[model samples]
Target: MRAVILPGKKEVQVVDRPKPVPGDGQVLVRMRASAICRSDMSLYYGGKPLVGGEAAKTGTIIPGHEPAGDVVEIGPGVRGLQPGDRVAVYLAIGCGHCTYCLSGYLSLCSQWKCVGFDVDGGDADYMVVPAQNCLKLPDPMSYETGALLLDNMGTQYHAQKTLGVSGNDTLAIFGLGPMGSAGVLIAKARGARVIAVDVLDSRLEMAKELGADVVINSTKEDAVEVLRELTHGEGVDKAIDSSGNPAAQNAALDSVRKMGSVALIGETSATTINPSEQMIRKLLKVYGIWIHPIWMFEEIANFVIDHNIPVDRYITHRFNIEQAAEAFRLFDERVTDKAVFVWD
Candidate 1:
């Protein structure tokens, strides 16, 4: 079996490895589709993965957290799923006895481990995961779409729901990366008027095609001013920042109307904000959004199917395991908006 391993900086390797077998309560899935994400860049660059404590520090685990495939074998204690089941493996594995895990908030559990970062992942031809971590993928869904459901698409879906985005609201999204692009699709599906902001013309163009009501070029134009003007000078009703860039984050905060809500989905370090001005003065409601709880996968998938949201629109490149080097290179260089590794 071929597997992708990032041993260190600027290196991508597809090495031959033994195919894994399922252990108790686990299932071995034959990998079908996996998506490359911006977060994977940390591992691609030889830096430690964002999760997985000591395992991530070793820097040898397969580097894909967004994966979906077909079940081939099930170990003892596995139930309700069998061979031929099409599923997307939720990335986090938590101590099942914990309250957070019991509530389906696996990522919130104290003893959570990430699949691709902490153990072998779907970057290989076969990988084993706890049966409980597998989310069923509907027959109508593509493997690529299934892979994205846990991360990019699901994150935006959770964020918008948190802010209660609806037809009555005007939403502004900063950053047009895949996450931001997903936000546009979800916001539009909810009937919100969407204003997308980005520095790149390519991304802003793609955002428009994905149903963004208005697109603002932050590099060439003033995104805040454009957002205000589009909302008839009242500012948008809600804002989301997916860039994690400080300037874009601040602009998202400033572009929304007083009392308007904002969701910060992107990960960033310390970003200075005036408490009195950005929070108190505006009476803003701000949410820090990470990947969603495991239970939300069903709702997100149904929403995707119900609204006919085109998840494939976010993908711009596809590769095989053998092309691991070039795949990460293009993604790292920002030449591809969203890239997937597809199996035969």
Candidate 2:
């Protein structure tokens, strides 16, 4: 198998590696489509930190997490799954017995392992994952659409869940990237009034096509002021920050009304908050979401299957496994909304 191995920062090569066999309770998936996430780009560009908070250290990591594939084989003791099943892989591998896992908060677990980050990932021909992490893909969906469920789509679902969106609230997302674009559709499907915010005119137009009630270009207009006026001085009911920029976070806080919730699901190295002084003063709820629980995968899978939201809209580029470096470069340039690796 040929896998892109990152031995260090700015060092990635498509090298021959042994194919992995599934262990107990695991499944070997022949990847059909795996998208390049921002985290993967960070690791490739030497911007992502090591998992243990170690700085300036990189390892032989194969980075990719958003994956959709066919089950090629099942490990021993794995039940309820068989070869030839189409599935989406959950990125987080948590100890099922941990307190965080028991409470459906796998991201907070002490031993939480994320595929493509802490563990081996789907950047190769075949990747092994826990059978429990597999969610059945709908019959008619393409592998590319199924691929988004793992991270990008799941992030939107988590944001909605975290904010307690009741389908009646108006939602605004900052940053019209893949996650933010998908969020428009998800929020609309939940019956919320959706607004998309970005500096990109094309993305804002795409968001409008995806059912956003309004679009705001923060570059040309004051986004916080516009939304406040649109809501008649009350501000939006929910605001999501996907830009991962400190300014976006502050803008989200400012754009949401009293008692409104703000969800952060994008990549952030470090961000400073004023000890919730503003949040307390405004009676706001701010949540920083990194990973969603595995169960949300199944739920989101159903949503995608039912609504058939245009997941393909996010794909502006596609590459093979060997073109990993170019993928990272193009993604960093922001020349495209989303990029994916399609296996032969």
Candidate 3:
């Protein structure tokens, strides 16, 4: 089997390795599509991993969390699934006995291990995962769409659902990357008027194509002011910040109406904001949303299929596993929106 490994410091290696055999309650999948996520750049840049156990710090684990493929083999004790099942692999591996795990919030388990970080992932010809982590893809879903739904689309879906975004709400999204683009699509499906803000014109343009009612270049124009104006001085009904940027985060906090909701989906270690002015005094509701609960995959999939969401439109580039280096480079430089590794 051929796999990709990031040996840190912007290095990418495609190496030959023995195909892994599934252990008890596991399954072997033939890789078909694997999407690159921004978090993967932590390993690419030799920084501390955003999530995982010790194995993630080693930089030897295959680095791909958003992946989907066809099952080829099942291990002992596995049930209800078999060869030829088309599925997307969930990123979190949890201790099934924990309260969080039992409730299907695997990532919240104290003993959780992140796929592609704490363990070998799907950036290869073949990979093995616990049977419980395989989310069966809908018949109408393509491998590319299945892969993307695991992260960007899934996260946005979960966030918007939590915020109760609806026809009466105006959503201001502070970022226009893959995640924000997904936000645009999902928000539009839910009937919300979306306002997208980003520094890059290319990203803002893409946001417009994805159904944003208005796009704001925060660098050229004051995003908070524009959002306020668009909402007739009342401020937006809801806001989401996926840029992980402090300035954008502040803008998200400052641009929503009093008592409005805000979901912060970006992974940032720290940022400063005034509680009194941006949150407390306004009685704002703020949520720190991570990945979706394991059980929510069914609902997310149904929503996408039912709404005919163009999930695959989020992808801007595709590469064979052999082009790992170029893929990482372009994604790191922000030259692509969503990049994926694919197999024939």
Candidate 4:
């Protein structure tokens, strides 16, 4: 088997390794597609992982959390699944008995381990995962689309569903990265008037392609002011900040209507904001959304299929596992919005 490993400091290695056998209650999957995420850059730079335990800092684990493939073998004790099952692997490996795990919020489990971080991931020809973590892909969904839905699309779907975004509301999304792009597609499917904001014109263009009603270059124009003007001074009905930039986060809080909601999907260590001015006075509904619950993949998949969302359009680059180095480099430099490793 061939696998990719990031040994820190922007180093990428594709090495040959023995194919892993599935352990009890596990399954071996033949890798088909795996998407790169911004958070992966932390490991690329040898920085502390954004999510995971001490094992993540070791950088010995294969680095891909968003992946989908076909099950080739099943381990002892596994049930209800078998060879040839096409599935997307969930990123979190939880202690099943915990309250959070039983409720399907695996990532919230105190003893959770992150795939691609705490353990070997799918950035290879083959990988093994617990059987419970496999999310069966819809028959029609492509492998690449299945991989992307695990993270970017799934996160946005969960956030917008929490916000109750609909045709009656206007949504201003900060950051036109893959997550934001997914936001645009999902918001449009829900019939919302979408306002996309980013510092880069290329991203804004992609947003427009994905059905944004308006695109704002925050660097050239004040996003909050423009959002207010577009809403006839009432402000957008809802806003989401996926940039994690302090300025954009504040703008998301400021650009919503008095009782409107905001969902912060971006990962950020710290940022300053005025609760009094942004939330207290307005009685705003603010939510901090992370990945969707493990059980939500079915709903997310149904929604995407029902709405005919162009989920694959979110990917801008694809590479064979052998091109792992250049793939990570381009993604790190922001040259690719969504990059994936694919197998024939």
Local accuracy of candidate 2 as per-residue lDDT tens digits, 1-344:
87876665666788888899999999999989999877766577565443523322355666778888899999999999999999888877788898888876666878777778777788888899999888888888888888887788888888887787767798889999888987887887788998889999988987887788999999999999999999999999999998898878888988899988999877677877764664988899888887777767768878877876777877889999988878877887778788999976
Model 3 lDDT-worst window of ten: 45-54
Clash pairs for candidate 1: none
> Which pairs of residues collide in candidate 4?
none
Q: Write the residue-wise lDDT of candidate 1 on 56-94 in tens digits.
A: 767678878899999999999999999999999999899
Candidate with more favorable, higher TM-score: 1 or 2: 1
Candidate 3 residue-wise lDDT at 166: 99
RMSD, one per candidate, in order: 0.9, 2.3, 0.6, 0.7
Q: Estimate each model's TM-score.
A: 0.98, 0.92, 0.99, 0.99
Per-residue CA lDDT of candidate 4, range 293-335, in tens?
9999999999999999998887899999999999999998899
Kindly indicate the candidate among 2 and 4 with the higher lDDT: 4
Better of 2 and 3 by lDDT: 3
Query: Which is the winner by lDDT between candidate 1 and candidate 3?
Result: 3
Please estimate how well model 3 matches the true structure, expressed as its whole-model Cα lDDT. Answer: 0.94
